[model samples]
Target chain A: MAIEIVQCGALITAALLMIIGLVALVYLDNVLKKIIGAAFIGDGVNLLIIALGYRVNGIPYIFLQNMDVNSFLGQASYPLPFALVLTSIVIGASTLAVMLALAVVLYKRNGTLSATALLNDKKLGEENNE
Target chain B: MDGTIFIPLMVVIPIICAVLVNLLHEHSGVTKIFGYIGAICLPIVPILAVYGNHFFGGYQPLANGGLTVALPEAANAIISGSFLELFHPAITYAFGPGQQVILFVLGLVAMCAVFISIAETKKTSGVYLYMLFMLSAALMAFVLTDDIFNLYVFFEIAALVQVGLILVSRVRGNYETGLKYMLLGEVGGSFMLLGIALILGLTGNVNISDIVMMIHTGLVNPTNPVLLFAAGMLIYGWLYATGLPPFNAIKSEIYSKGLPSGSMLLQSFSVIACISIGLVIIRIFGYLPTAQMAMLAVSVIAMILGICMAMVQDDYKRIIAYLAVGELGYIGVGLGLATPLSITAGLFQAVNELVVTSFLFIGFGLVLYKTRTSKISKLGGLVEYMPVAALLTVLAGFAMAGVPPFNVFQSKYLLCQAAIAAGIPELAVIMIILSIVTFLAFLKMAYAIFLRPKPDELEVSSASVPKTTMAVMIVFLIICLIIGLFPGLVVDKLGVLALTAFAL
Candidate 1:
């Protein structure tokens, strides 16, 4: 029961991270801050995935010499989600880099990091002539 | 040799092309040759390759003797006694006849887009070509891969490549549009990952086939709250990916900001995204009526909003972009219906959309290329200047509006049929009425852009349309005609997917 509680706590933290990040993303007016929020969302998902693989008082996923294979299989923390999180991190970082780079360029062009100033529908609608 | 070799090559060739082109960007001559070769290969590889599943790194199921390490007898026994034995241990890409057809059409549109890209430009930028190839590779991966995780990897790649494609265009406000899309993508994409994670947590697998099998065989309870949440998240991601509702405006904005060629390819990616992600959703959640209802509801709204919003647009590009998205609702309706016939019809609509929408984008693109602007009110009497292009553009519009003897007509007819077969006759009426509205709306734009008297301030350029562009447009028209006259050519192949989906 204690182990499950700890696991649930971690899951809750992950969910909170995601919620906060999403709130920052939608409600925050700053473009750079929104990017940060986006990063947080990725971080939250990574945490959730890692949390899913967490085992209470579990053995390593690898097998050792002369180990009991059945016990090893039953007790080992999952390795799959870890591998997934690794890839997701790389993808998330690259995507962040692109978004950040785009933000920098938008700032240079429009001279503002305010999302409303740049990305609002009114601004977009007025841009058809060019 | 297993016929699966072509499957991986389908993805690899594009990446390879991207790298080569990026390297040779400084040399336009070399880049041009590489670009042509790469574009031609996109369609040809699909044609030459046989269909089958390719297990990456040769990691098939342990039950199939795919293990490299000798496992203990006890571990093997445990795996053998449960659903684990049948689960794929590696990333899998399944290339069925349906995928083949769709991929082929995608490759064709991509090929034409590239052909036009190379020919239309004074000198091709390797960076632009690089973005194009990467976008194709990502979209192809999305279609070919059976692993949802693999799909995620390429999903990010697709999103980034799409932004790069928009940025490659010198269109005003492109950077703003690209950044905005990325910002929105962050929300949509992160949630999508969370959804995939939830499914992974529940099923202990990332391979879609394994997850599906586990759920179907009662290894993982499908109705679990976590699983339902995952479905909801996945559906949210689908809406974002395909630009169905709240995202529709952004998606059409994306189309309007790209070069005509780039927009042509961009719309294909969205259509492919709609098909790929929507199929995954259906496969996992189709049994749930709520899931199907959600899909149907969004699709109907997208159809209505897409056309109505388009009718009010003054910019020709925006109009076509909205129309493209509006037409997307048909595919959504077809897939949302979740019946075998509806699924096939949906798939068919997707294929037709790839062709027809690309045709319209390219046709309208000619006007944009000749004139510096895409505003409908700024131009008129184009038929007097380029007779062939004007007539072809009008025909493309007809195809979009579902006029007879065009590919969209055939697909729309199938969609209506599928909707009725699913016991929702009202859905059929909606589709028919929308089809007519689509026609009228397109005719309005056609008249404004092609037939209206020339404005005094309209600077009509006398430059001849590129012969290559003409050839591509003619070929596209022929394809639409062929499909319209013989819908069986597509529906028969697409039906395989619907049947196979039911088998799942």
Candidate 2:
């Protein structure tokens, strides 16, 4: 079986997105940016799954009425990646919901979304106790 | 035919109940009924499934029979066992004697406590939904899974639901604690994902059996950096999830943030997550001597550090929280030892800890309700007034200390014996010494709160005994006694199954 160049490109793109997401979470102080980074990584995964099904000049995975069975069998895109993307999408949505829920809870408690404010509060509380 | 629909229903039933109860939240009476039905149904489903699957063998293909649940492929790579290796990932669910039975029994006891708790609190619906979700997910992951990736997915789902349940208590400071939990959980999730990616990259198969077959052929070389990195990532993930040393601070903070009722839920999740994660690592990397060493070091750190921290705590819940940390260490030690005896002992210890700790945490909940405080030094002489509560509380504390005729003692004995058999006499001695310290500390607590002289102004009313709360405590206590008496009933069966799971 011949490897598709487009599929290779998509995998590399997904890998880069994941690396970027990791860096953003680690290096950025802003919480919203961190969330966006996570979203990008999730999108990248969805893209990779789609790409895995790609075949050069392959016809869409649809049946035409009156088409011969032999011709119909040879043209369909892979079905497994389509199913995987659906599963990944559900997992990704749930993760987003949780991350958002936590972020909202944090905002309600502390009144600021910045990491700096959290650090400041901790330092202040410690000094007062001392 | 290990029944498929029943296993999936294990998760589905509670979820449906959660939705129904949440809709009827305004009608407390309706919610209570829903709660009772849920509690009773949750454990029966899995227990009945085991019986039906064993007897009927109406085995439909799981994931179209792609995933085969066999022991050698699931646990030890080299050990051969009879089981089908599924072509695609399907539920290759099987049962034996050892950890699976222990977990089922633990799940039963936890459900009993949860039911009693329904009567303990009012206007609290949908909490049981999360509880059932956590239980079913943990058990499904523990028993049915044949792929490492599926196990990781269940771990993530359980962690997410568990953190949500912890915050649902809506107690003060809970948000912050939940945040910490989410952060740690995210890191753990990332590490586990990376580990899965590495394993797949090396072997091109996510199904555990194929990975093992590849490893056996030297196609997946042990010295591969990706494999080593995957191993490290897996261990670190286990540490965070289990709340081992250095991670204890977060566990303490999270447990303290929730009300005791909520803490009861958190504690059980902690036990399940730790054991499941440990089991996964042991399954994947059991052949590696270095991985065994790392597990041993973690077990030691958890036991020693947890007890040391527990000793100085004035807050009663914090003390128990620390002790829970240490108790998990005993489980880890059993897995680390990896001998048949030790692994069985560790799994048995896990069951003991589940029952005893639920009782202890719930028993403490009654105190929190009465005194409106969890501070040990602030209250005394509870035995004079709340005699029943005091009795249950004492029983739970003693059980935790590995007292005879209590659930934990049997497992504790086996852990020591197993450690000795493994030529680690020092671990056995350390465990013995830790048990002594644990007993002394609990004794101090018992004396200060229940046995010591009563202070004036502390009122004990018959009203203090919530009928529902009493029901919960009694139910939990009965489970502890029942399991303590028939150790082999659960251990022999669960151990055999767990050993078989590993062998496949």
Candidate 3:
């Protein structure tokens, strides 16, 4: 019952994180906040994945000497989610690195981090004649 | 031979090559030798792949498909004893009937572009590392898998590497362009992930073949919204990756900022990834009427927006960038038509566009070298100062305009047949109008930049055209000629496979 409760708590946490991310994406005026929302979504996804991988009362999946096959099959800790989480983390980190580098460049070029400001700059020369 | 091993190795080899090249890049002589070696060796696996398909029927080059080959008893025992959950336990390399041949040709040409870029750059930088790495990852992800999630992972990796390469060039204005690309591209990636998550939840599996089988087995709802969402995410991702209309802002910026040779590789990688994913999504999810409608909508937007935007661009590279985006739409529309002729025309155009762009961009790069500017207005009377460069540029320009005796012309003609056959003669008319617009734009640019009297600000370079530059141009030109003269050589090989795959 406690294990079930913990699983419920995880789901709730994941939902909360996701909702906050969506709201942030929808309402945030600042570009940096949107980025933070993006990160929040990534975090929420990771948490949800871990929650799905959760096995009640499941110990580490190490195969011990003389391990009983029946017991293992019945309640083996799920390792697939763990592996997936790790891969997703690596991918997320690389993406973050590239994003940060780009953000820095954008800031340098336009002197602002606001998307609207940047869009305006993109339209800089076109406004004169038309 | 083993799918489990070969699939990952395709991504790994180029990574290893990138590392080695980066280490040796400081040594000019060593870098040259290593680049040549890498270029020559890169195509062997693809060559072997073609032969492998013939010898071992239905064997995909990489082992991740649903079909599995049983491991030898001994090896199985060892793995079983070790309690190792092999990520890939037994090789289940499944290549859809004739995908191997089409993938092989695309892979060969992509590698060819990389070799040509390496030869042209003549400078030691991180660019080559990113170039080879991006190409390898793109092709590996493209050819080796029938899995949707794996495709997403590889696509993200390739996008990162290509963005890195675009930034590596110290050319003016690329930094801003690269950032815009990164922001917008990650949004696309996130959508793809969202789609994958929903699909996994709905289908209980991540493998595309498993999902396809499940659909056939009645275990999956063909009209599930989750499946529709997944298809939508992937198509959007491809659009952003390929630089189509809605996402054209970022792609145009990057192409306008990066060097021409680099842009050639970037363009090919983006287009191939788009077409591959676009085709796969159409194949796997075409059962859904909504999915087909959605794809048709994206194709229309991309086609209309691409050429219209191309008609208005002032910068030479931006014009090419818009056309590249537009051309991808044409390919997308062909894929959408889902006819044998259309699919073949799309694939044929893909290969031709890649080849034709190489010459035009290289010619423009050479012109940039001679004139030191990319703006059409600033470039004038190149005929007097650099006759050879101007002549080649004109030929490339004509090819882009779809003139006769060029590969693009043949491909475009087939695309027209495809449109008309699909009962979209209006689209055929639009295509012809766009071709005319492209011709007029190129003619204006050519006359303004190359044929007219020299602008005082345009400086002719004291140095002669590098042998390597000329060689790259000649090589691409010859490829265009070969494809143009005998379209069947490529079409005969790739057409049937594309038709079979897209036919469902």
* Predicted structure with the largest TM-score when compared to the true one: 1
Model 3 segments more than 4 A misplaced: A1-31, A51-67, A77-79, A104-112, A116-130, B1-10, B50-122, B499-504
Provide the TM-score for each candidate, comma-separated. 0.97, 0.84, 0.86
- Residue-level lDDT of model 3, residues B1-504, one tens digit each, is 554334344455666666777787777666666666655555555544422222123443232242256654453554453413212322233343245444554555555656656665657554465566566656655665666666777777777777777777676555555655666666677667666666666765665655565665567787776677677877777777777767875676666566675777677776677667777776677676566566666767876787777677667777777777777777777777777788888878877776777677778887777766667777788888778778888888888778888889998999999889888898889888888887887888889888988878768888788776787677777777888888887778667657645442
lDDT of 1 by residue, A1-130 (tens): 8988988988898888888898999899999999998889899999999999999888778889888877888899999999999999999999999989989888887789999898888878888654
- The native-contact fractions of the candidates, in order shown, are 0.77, 0.09, 0.22
In terms of DockQ, which candidate is strongest? 1
Name the best candidate (by lDDT). 1
* Tens-digit lDDT track of model 2 for B1-504: 545456556556766776777677777787778777866776676665643222123333332332234432322232223232332333334343343465465456546655655756656565555454454446545555556666766777777766776677665555555655665566666666667666766765666655666665576687887798889988988888788876886786666656565676577767776777777777778788788788888889999988998898777877888899899999999988877788888878887787788788878877777776667767888887788988899889999999888888888998999999999899999999999999999999988888887677665545566876777778778877877898887678657745742574
TM-score for model 3?
0.86
Whole-model lDDT values for every prediction: 0.88, 0.70, 0.68
Instruction: Candidate 3: give the TM-score of chain A.
Output: 0.83
Ranking by lDDT: 1, 2, 3
Clashing pairs for predicted structure model 1, backbone only: none
Candidate 2 per-residue lDDT over residues A1-130, each given as its tens digit: 3466667887899778877877776677776667666666666656755675676767776768876555555666756456556765676678778777878867886788875665243542232122
Candidate 2 local lDDT, residue A21: 77
Off by over 4 Å in 2: A1-29, A33-86, A116-130, B1-5, B51-86, B89-91, B127-141, B217-219, B453-462
Docking level of model 1: medium
| Greater-TM-score candidate between 2 and 3 | 3
Cα lDDT for residue A42, model 3? 68
